[model samples]
Target chain A: MNSAASEPALIGLDWGTSSFRASLIGADGGVLDRLAAPEGIMHVEGGLFEAAFTRLLAPWAGHSDLPVLASGMITSRNGWVETPYVGLPAGGKELARAIATHQTTDGRTVHFITGLASETDGAPDVMRGEETQIVGAVAMDTSDGCFVMPGTHSKWVEVSEGRITRFATYMTGDVFAALRDHTILKALMQDAPFHDEGFRLGVASGLSAGSELLHRLFHVRSMPLFDKIPAGASADYLSGMLIGAEIAGGSAGKANRGPVTIIGRDDLADRYETALGIAGLTTRRAEPDIVARGHFTIAKAAGVIA
Target chain B: MNSAASEPALIGLDWGTSSFRASLIGADGGVLDRLAAPEGIMHVEGGLFEAAFTRLLAPWAGHSDLPVLASGMITSRNGWVETPYVGLPAGGKELARAIATHQTTDGRTVHFITGLASETDGAPDVMRGEETQIVGAVAMDTSDGCFVMPGTHSKWVEVSEGRITRFATYMTGDVFAALRDHTILKALMQDAPFHDEGFRLGVASGLSAGSELLHRLFHVRSMPLFDKIPAGASADYLSGMLIGAEIAGGSAGKANRGPVTIIGRDDLADRYETALGIAGLTTRRAEPDIVARGHFTIAKAAGVIA
Candidate 1:
């Protein structure tokens, strides 16, 4: 195992509901190679996760004793193992202690990272993959700050002293997508693009509509019919409102005096960054592979690969 | 024409997307008889609104010279004719001034009531059927107050001195239905009933999340999994949140020294009433046929029926 130190550093597996990607990282924390499959945990046929896992990684069976780290929905009750969520205030080193492991029939060891559960006073919240991203985030900046990860389920996380102190999730994307197709505004904007001007206006509207999203959404209908909102701007307006409302809603009570960190693919992160700017809040974009880095960082500190 | 007035006070027709209801009113503005059909403007095939209206009313061809007053989507671009919207601060008197007339083949003139347009400082807002309801509400009580009409597209209207001064639309029911059937929350709430306790909890969450509805919605997913929110309560909780958030967002920026008038069917109005109570606001329920009253009141004031 120690002899593989010069070989590929580690395998980072981000397995979610609809897809899974495996990143081969070098000892220098650089991604050397990667593989992704359409086999998300939801569509993992017949519950043959191990068989699927091995078949997916069959190409690298003989690549030394490289330890595999897994994250995302694959660790849930429906996935391979129901890894109990590690409660709030945990980072890479702390998360390392509660890692779940399994030995493959093909003579290899795989380590699955558990998700994080919040200790918030309102509701019990949890996240599986973002914890890794946040860890990957903390790996770069250990100082205290709030982090925004935009996606289907966008997470607003707070990190202080190397641990994920608290967080919240906003279903911004899903709600916007569904509403676009499901509501009346969908008809007028079926072919509308995300116009920059319209989007900015929507952000402003969303701030005004904050939490009153139901009432606010209809503006997409009235504004257009009123010609106040031009043609092809309804969709952008919807997007802006959702994102703006999300920022207002996600950061409502928090004492966010400083800038927040946003982590996601370039496109999604860019949209959030734009809206954050409109809301007069500053933001820094986290590296795209922050999750992979977190996997590498946390696994290393856990002594799983060393 | 005046002789026919004795036969029937007026015919108040509520024509909308999915259904059309024709109400026969007496000289006293009381509903004498009613007829409903599935031929809403949307389902009316072949654009034969005139033919359909004739065929549907053939059952009472010679009953009276009742000036049929049509409202709702039937006057939109897709309906028989696009009766232009009457601008805001319009009650029955102002609306009457903008009435459009259509001549039927039988030499009868149908009086089409135009929808109301808001002169609000922001975008142009319009409503067809709700305006009639508001007019009717005004007929009953000519005072300053906010009105909540809960439905697929809920209307938050303000009336002063018999005129619909301002109004806003909340797609609360539509959003909830779509989120239930189109989003991830739908998966968790396949059979979620409106649990009373869950509804209360959801209402509170909604008020908290109203400013951040997108952020707060995700709690439906995590709280259930964390065992903090019981199974099957997610849907109800979501309902409460949407309703509660609507109140907060809708009521924001408004000065309400008086109670609101909530109009709708029993179930939705009841839920809204309960939520309004929880939100520390007072609500008075309007009759189910309030729309008819509005139409009749406006038509009488305008001398459409005498």
Candidate 2:
């Protein structure tokens, strides 16, 4: 490996509630190296965040001068620095302007990216790290389309002119986990391979006109009881129903935003893609290393790295 | 208590999965004496249901000759006698005709009232205890209307000519509990007295046209964050949203089924009544002791008692 080609220019950190991931990005927008750990904001005991950060980044100690860009829940009220949320119509430049600087005890500087809040809708919706991912996605594709980030709390963001116009968050994955593991539906669910037919049925049901989710969820229980679907496939069916409902709710009035871009891991992105197809919408998966790319973009806009 | 007026004619047991309620009905179809315990079917150790029943009924051992009628999950597959479910368009007569008898160790016969199933809809739905409650409601009103039984799994039943024709189940309460206690929304919730305004706001949001539940639920977290509602009221807000969604789904096509009869305990029925009223549907509470009344009506229809 050529040392100059692999020289680290910026350290990007995606520090969320349950996991921590850091990337060493080269000046040419390439990933020099990457490291991840389970030490999220919630896991660091005794307010030892600075120590944890320093210890985790010890592998690239030779590149100590590289500017560090931190995002996710790490900037929340319970995190290392509580940054104010940037309102709608925000992107890399806006996030760069609002970036708060934290000085580590070791005389190093860390830039924290603020989250975005959507107040245009009835009730307020907010996202921390996903804003960066959206910025990264916009950087990859300059089109004005919607991005579906499927996760514990799936986000549906609308982007125009390389800035996030508005977005909505659906507790799809979180609710699915709670229902499948804690409710009466758990009795009928068994570990099984992905069932395509069950998922399609679920998506169709979720997207059905005048279908209420509370009623549709009970079908997860009744479907197996009536042998409409085998018990083993109930989990995936439940997944499809939730994802489909999310797409229905997220794309209620924004159907003309063109094809959706799914930004997440392949497994979940694939599920969202299938559910969106079932809902008669097309989708494309975003490139990998979205967080790292977002960090690099924001770092450049903030002038932290030149 | 006059002995003649309190003359026991039948023993009615509303035994369910998590609760056991037994009522002694007099010849005049009035409750003579009642007993309740936490010994639901699941609590009976080692399939010793007969022993538990005998011990629980030991208080009324002097009236042992009175025929006992058991309903609820006591007739389910996991109960003492696994009675098959009776199909739709069933009432007291149908339930009486399908009652299965089990001989206890002491040679006493316990008649288990079967549940009802609805296969008319796309998917199948079954109910064990609520069917008897509906029968009792029909006996009191004798009206062709809709019955909303709100509990862990809320049931909406369409009754015509004193028979349940079709019905649907919504996991409103169960999902509410799961989401409130186990999900990310739990962080913003605080236990407090019911907030009427918060509940009203939730109901209006839930009853909004084209509203999706997954999105509405996120408002429970956002409302507080945005200062639209206090943290203490979030619990009630969540409850109202779920109950309101239930009403939306339950009364979708049956708005003209006359006033909905709420068949449940006072607190839950009150919540359902409020949510239904918010959804522009009138509601009336069912009479207490509906289970005992149902048991007596079925016993008389089956000639188990004069």
Candidate 3:
């Protein structure tokens, strides 16, 4: 690594409910070094967030003057600094405007990036950390397109003119996990490598018109009972079905504007890519470290980085 | 009770996964006596189903000759005696014809009533015990209609000419329980009595056209987050949303032939009734002890009771 490029300009943190990750960013917005721990806000004991943050950043102790930008659940009500959500159409500027800051015990200021809330007419939708990624995506590809972010709570975001316009959240991953591990469907599912055929079948079924998820989920049990899908592949089948249903709801009423940009881990992104293809939609993967890019963007918009 | 109606004619058992109920039926199809215990098929230790059955039915020792007809998960693979499923269009006669008999250790004959399977041109749906209730409903009305049986796994049965033509299973209750108790939506939820307003809002949202269960389920979290709904009532809101989604899927493509006959406990039936009303469909409750009536119907068809 070049010595100049290794110079830390900003400290970026992606802290969620169960995992924490921090990245040291160069002036040119490249991640110079990174650290990860199971020190999510939820796991931080006795509210010792200051000490935990200090310990996690011990490797970069000398860079105390570097601006720190934190995102994800670390900015929630239960997190280190509670930041109000920035309502749509919000971009990095709006998020930076709403950033809540906390002065650490060590005289360091940590700027907690606010999340985004949808302005939809029906039930409201909110996100904690995904808005930063959305901003990063917009910065990378200044196009108006939809972003499918798959995770425990998958978010379908629509970005237009460098700002989030409207979005919806699908409990696809969490619901899949809950159903797979807690319901009768678990009895038929066995852990195995990802099964492509089973997933394709599930995606087709999930994307089928008038397909109801609650009803189709029962098929996870019946499909195995009838030997339509192997028991070991039922988990993948269920995952596909859920992701397909998410796509169905997520993509409804929107004209085929463009290929949806998928921003998620490789495994989940792969599943969504396959399912979206089955749904007759094209998809492209977002670059890795979008969260770090997102933090950089928000911090720059906040004038913390030059 | 009338002395004649008090005489036991058949022993009807609704042995399910988590609960067991046995009813003594009179020749006139009236329930003469009833016994229930926590001794579901799953709770029977060391596969000692025979011993558990004997202990639970010690009250009817003198009526050992009474033909025992068992339904529900007790006939499933995990239960005492596994019986194959009877395909649609199946009624009491078909169920009786497919009944598998198991000779108890005390020389008593216990007939296991097979469940019903849909012959639809897609993924097959099966139910172990709801078919009996559907048969009982047909026996009572003798009219073709849809039966919405709400429980852990809600079944929507289509009956025509006194037989189950087709049916679909929705994991509404099971999914609700799983999400409520196991997912993040549980965080904002406080266990409270059912809230009508929250439930109505959820039902209306759930019944909305283009409503997707996976997407709307996220509202359970966001609704509370935004204080659009009280945290305590979120559970009921989630329930309504799920039930409404179930109604949406369960009623799709079916012409409004008549009011859906709801065969379930009073509380769930009430919720379904309210949700179906919101969906602009009428509903009527099936009489109590449809299981006993079902047993009587199957026993009569099998010539075990005359």
Candidate 4:
């Protein structure tokens, strides 16, 4: 490797569905420089995933043959190399063993981390990039409980003894987007910054709404008619209700219930924390860069770099 | 009025979002003939509702000065005339009292039967067309209990002493369509006939899915991965889950524990009946043409005809 063996230990990359994020990690597991590109797994066309990624990483051409640790949708079926999801009770070690390796034309050794496949008897559940975040979060705090990572497909992971035992996936953001963009509720909501009181009320309503999520959602439109819920607050309220329902259902049978460790951006993580709080659950937030931290942890375990 | 003063008794119309259905009702409450046109409320454009409806009814020009009774979206804000929703505990007589009369230049007195508005303390819930169906269903069965009308916006209505007591609305069909057309699960589904066993299992799963509908729904994608639910069966299972959740939420705290009277088409009614049966509830379907039957009963209550 061109760089000193211990100088910059790894190049960590998190390529998700919509965006590609990378960070240069030093031997001390600290991020040196963060890089990003619009070339997410989905946006990269054809099978030119490696070429596209290489071009994006051309800025660091001098660091030859630097071992890279990649996670997220990059290891998915549509990604460069389809890495098999390791079944859970997975941890950093399980993820490290299943790392799929590839070489770019520029001779960079890229080690990709596979995700966790939930051991569900009924439905086959899986998560690609979130497992890395789990490792990163667990590494930071050795406590075991449920961890929530909210996004388009928010994940509720069960962590026990530093291992991801089981989990559930909720399409909270996807359903909300579909309803807003495609359904009539779109017309009912107004553009307004999220108000917490409205969100709390929404959580209350959603929980009381029972199992009939489809039925309760209609109230978003009707509440405005009687001026019960203002139009501007409707979006936040809807968000709260969906998130509330997700928490109620996801936490149904979990034996290890305590303060959930949330790993995400500020806005989404805060929303989930708020809802979880309202649902009588406590939560602690890991650092925002858990995905990168995860990559660093997995890469170290795989010996991709010293 | 023309046509022997009592021959065409009353002209009944069911104008909803997608289409306009009209029936010529004789004094004996029998439909002499049914006429349908694609000119639904959405199609009647440019503030020419009366004009468009007049052109469609030009075939019945002979019945000049005949009083017309209209229900459904044609009575909403976007319809020809915006009628108010009567509060719940409303029945045939209450609906008759709230009829908004209009003058269609075809020399006809159009008596529009307004819908019932649910008394939701948190949201202003209302249904324009389903109330007519409830009126008709109650007239036929006279057994006072809860009535469910499954459609684009499925409704659960309560009745007591032959009067509509209260109700709630679920966007079951709307959400189903949104997922089928807008969500990723659409790719995993196919155009297959409704499978009863699959639907039953779905209902069981949905009801038992507890509150985490947002999470359980993701299993629709994964179930096939584990060979738990087939690709074709996924659609039926998803449908069952949504419908089951609706029943669980809608039926909560209802005083009337008797068998629900479902007023809908055969397919939807049967699916609901199956789900309800699995939930340990009994159901009996009302006549298929509850909307038409409702309009007829309302027309008579309004004294627009004998």
Candidate 5:
């Protein structure tokens, strides 16, 4: 084992449903190197996560003594192992304690971080690794602001001072899938990724005529009936309807007085920015690998590294 | 056939998915008698509708000498026959022509009404028998306003003078079935129909939190993960989310500048009124049998009966 004086060693693992990435970082918070594996917690069956991880890191077998800190669905109920949920206003300590301690066949310290939870108007919402990203985002900023992390389940979190005040999760992913696959809106869309014109139109239609979104939604099916708008615009129309409604309702704009900073890919950020602009709000953008950065900040705060 | 001196004889049929009711009215507009049958268009094998109708209406077999008017699924593509759409601001004469004029197994005068089509913002919407209801509603008052005829596919129609201006259908019943049967919200509801409290709460939740409705919806599954919001409450919550969102979005609410009237059973009318109240509108009650009244109005308009 490396002494703290020599260079404390720690490994940070970002594991999710479909992929896994791990980094070996020095005590100074510098990455030595990283390894990626397609075999995520979601891909592996229960009870085999340990073996999968062992094979994944076999090349780095020499670092058997490093402390392992993991995040993502690897800790979900159906993941490698189920970790207990930590209640609202959760932080690093809560996450660390909720982590399940494990010993690999080669004898390594394995700790999976806990997910975050909060009640919105008495309804409960939870997030796993996103909490790490929030921690990093908060660490990067001195003032309080809302964080919008766009993904399958887009989360908008509020932070006051250093604590996670509250958060809400939108099934933007599910809606995307549903509209694209299950709804008649699918017919009106091109196979290509959403065009900006379509996206903009959708956002505009959603907001300007937002109150009628639901009623007008059926027209996506009825349009071809009366020989009017092309069916291909249905997908765009639906996207605009959902996102426009989100923006009009202030979901992606600001939080209690804090500005919004969206953390995602460039195109998505642009779309969101466009949506927010339409809803009359200015927003900032951040491109750091949020979960990895969040985990790094957590490891640093815990004094195990950095 | 016996006839009244001033009015022409007319037959009005309210054929629906599950049942059929035909009223034979006199030239002076009195119901000569009613005929009921189980052979809803839904039960028939499409082309067999003519044969099925002939078998059921053997008594009025001679009515072939009179003008017979029909409403309902009989005009849908899969019903008796598909009638070409009549453009908006128009009525059902072409629809009458489109009807399969069967020289029945025995001859009969059969006239089917055509569905109405209107376009808004480039999207087209259509309504079938509801045009008859709008015709009926207008007969009561020729001034411009909105008229809502609620059912499985609830139609909110706008009319001015004698023309149907615009219309939209809300899948209110479909949503009700989906929420009550397939989702976690069902856990929160009882099989038996409950009263006004939950219904009113559902409407209010939909109105204020309508934008977050989808976000709140995902929690119907996650609620049991942390706190104990009854499964039944989830049902109520979902119902509220949909109906409430509709109220906020004005699904059945009309854009016309006149009083709103709801037509349905007492319980349903109360729910709509409550939803309308939440939307900041007042409503008057109309007879639930708008179809029958619609039949009478169309007959009068066509001079088939006065």
Candidate 6:
């Protein structure tokens, strides 16, 4: 250890299935530089994880001894090392304890953040790295409300008093893939441009006639067997059917049932807001740099940086 | 025309997808003879439907011209003709009126059975020839309750006062096939005799941890990858997951949603009953011959036979 401790630098990283992201930050919380690579956990063997990560950070090799925090699949069972899920309503300290630290050849310390767990409507949702983003969003806004994070397994999170109160995961993207690829509805579609009409129809379908949605999903295939419906629009119709159901199911939850504050890229957030708005909920947009904000908030709370 | 208008013979036929059954009855309501053949709707091309049916019933040839009643998929949009679905809480009469009839080579009149439809828990369910079976089940037990007919698409129907009040369709069989054929779960299974312990464990997993069901589903691939769970039991586990959900979803309508009366072949019905029983539902066995019995009931009611 040096006498001045070399003024320890800080780092934040978001490591997902197919991609990796990292940022080098000064003690003042400003990004000095960043790096990214196609080194998501999925493509590499477990033993090669640490080496792959280190090579990606080699450009900023001077700060190799810096304190680094990582999130996402890096903590999954197949990840570098399993960082046990700390569970929902979990905050900075709990997640901090779950982090796995490793050393690069040059001596930098790496801390992999833990995922989160929460039970909603009797179902449990476990998210590996998004909790950090959620904390950042709340810290930036300091607002007690709902946060919608859209992805393959979309999550709607409720937060109050600076802690994640509850969350639910919907298999929206996976369901879309299954229906489009596996069902007869595939015959009725062409790769057409996206239209607000298609998405709007889906949102309404999900809310008003929500219960009959799944049953009608079967008819998507049956109707075209006869001359009742044209095949070209079946894919579009199926999309509406699923999206509608998801919007309705998400809103059915009990906590922070008030309004929603969506934190995501502009387009996704807009789409979510459009759907939720139709379902009669008020909405607001949070900054797009949610993961970074969450990292900053947690760092401050944990006394890692002022 | 003969001066006496010789009493027309009455013919009852069950024209299903894979096979055909014909019963010739005298005006006295006694079966004079029965014939079975492989010439079902599934074997013939669309335009060749009539020729196939006439060829199969050749043994009943030379019998006086008759009013022939048929049931099953032969009347679907893909079959002989489309018989419009009559919404349920319906009886044999409603189905009869919807049948599309045609004249055969020997001046025999053919009356095809229409399907039935109903709404439950805000979802619409439809059945083709199976409507006849429900009528038969009700005739066998007029006291009335819930009757479950298991097959490719299993149905749990509520019958009251000789009418099918409402019903729901569960994709239990189709899901089983998809999992067994298309998923990672397929890798774990073998053709040897199934272990009921594996089956029971799946059911227990679904019931007790029903809410976390989807999360567990995603990890099906991960568990084997990490060696946390065996690959061999994955198929059995998947079967249990789907069937378990079916048991829960199917029994939601009965009183305390009491035991369901399963009407099908002994083996398949027994499996369903056992699974549902494990999920805490009462189950009873009904005859698999419900379709044939309902055919006779309709013939008697039509005055085609005494």
| Candidate number achieving the greatest DockQ relative to the actual structure | 1
RMSD vs true structure, all candidates: 3.2, 2.2, 2.2, 3.4, 5.7, 6.6
Cα-based lDDT at residue A229, candidate 3: 86
Model 5 per-residue lDDT tens digits across residues A1-306: 112343537778888878888877666544666889888776886558888888888878888777788888788877866787677676555555566777767677777787877777666788877887776666656446777776666788777767787888876555565555644345556665565665666677666554455565666567545444445555665666667766665454453464687887676677788877777766887646445556666766665554
Question: Candidate 3 — which pairs collide?
Answer: none
Please state the error at residue B57 of candidate 5 in Å: 5.2
| Higher-scoring candidate on lDDT, 2 or 5 | 2
Alpha-carbon shift of residue B35 in model 5 (angstroms): 6.6
Q: Give the least accurate 10-residue stretch of model 5 chain B, judged by summed lDDT.
A: B91-100
Clash list (residue pairs), candidate 4: A249-B212
- Locate the minimum summed-lDDT window of 10 residues in model 4 chain B: B1-10
lDDT of each: 0.82, 0.86, 0.85, 0.80, 0.66, 0.66
Alpha carbon lDDT of residue A258, candidate 3?
A: 86
List runs of model 4 lying over 4 Å from the truth: A1-6, A104-107, A252-257, B1-6, B193-197, B252-256
lDDT per residue as tens, model 4, A1-306: 122344666788889888998877777676767789988988998868887888877877666456788899888878888988898799998898998888777676788898888755366788988899889888766778888888889898888898999888888888988887778888877788777777888888776665767777888888777677777888888899888888777766543566787877788888988888787777888876667678878888887755
Which of candidates 2 and 6 reaches a greater DockQ? 2
Scored against the true structure, residue A19 in model 2 reaches a CA lDDT of 91
Q: After superposition, how far is residue B211 of candidate 2 from its true place, in Å?
A: 5.5
Q: TM-score of the candidate numbered 1?
A: 0.94
Candidate 5 lands at a TM-score of: 0.76
- Residue-level lDDT of model 4, residues B1-306, one tens digit each, is 112333666678889888998887667666666789998888877869878778878888776556788999898888889998888678899988889888766456888888877767466688888888877777766788988888878998888898878888889888888887788788878898777766877787777765767877888888876677677787898899889888877777653588888878778888898888888787888865566667778878777776
Clashing pairs in 2: none
TM-score of each prediction: 0.94, 0.95, 0.95, 0.93, 0.76, 0.76
- As a TM-score, model 2 comes out at 0.95
lDDT of 6 by residue, B23-60 (tens): 66555434566789887776886558778877787887
- Model 6's CAPRI class? incorrect
Identify the CAPRI category of the predicted complex in candidate 1. medium
After aligning candidate 4 to the native by TM-score, how far in Å is the CA of A166 from where it should be? Answer: 1.9
DockQ of each: 0.75, 0.64, 0.68, 0.75, 0.32, 0.14
Candidate 1 vs candidate 4, DockQ winner: 1
DockQ: the better of candidates 1 and 2: 1
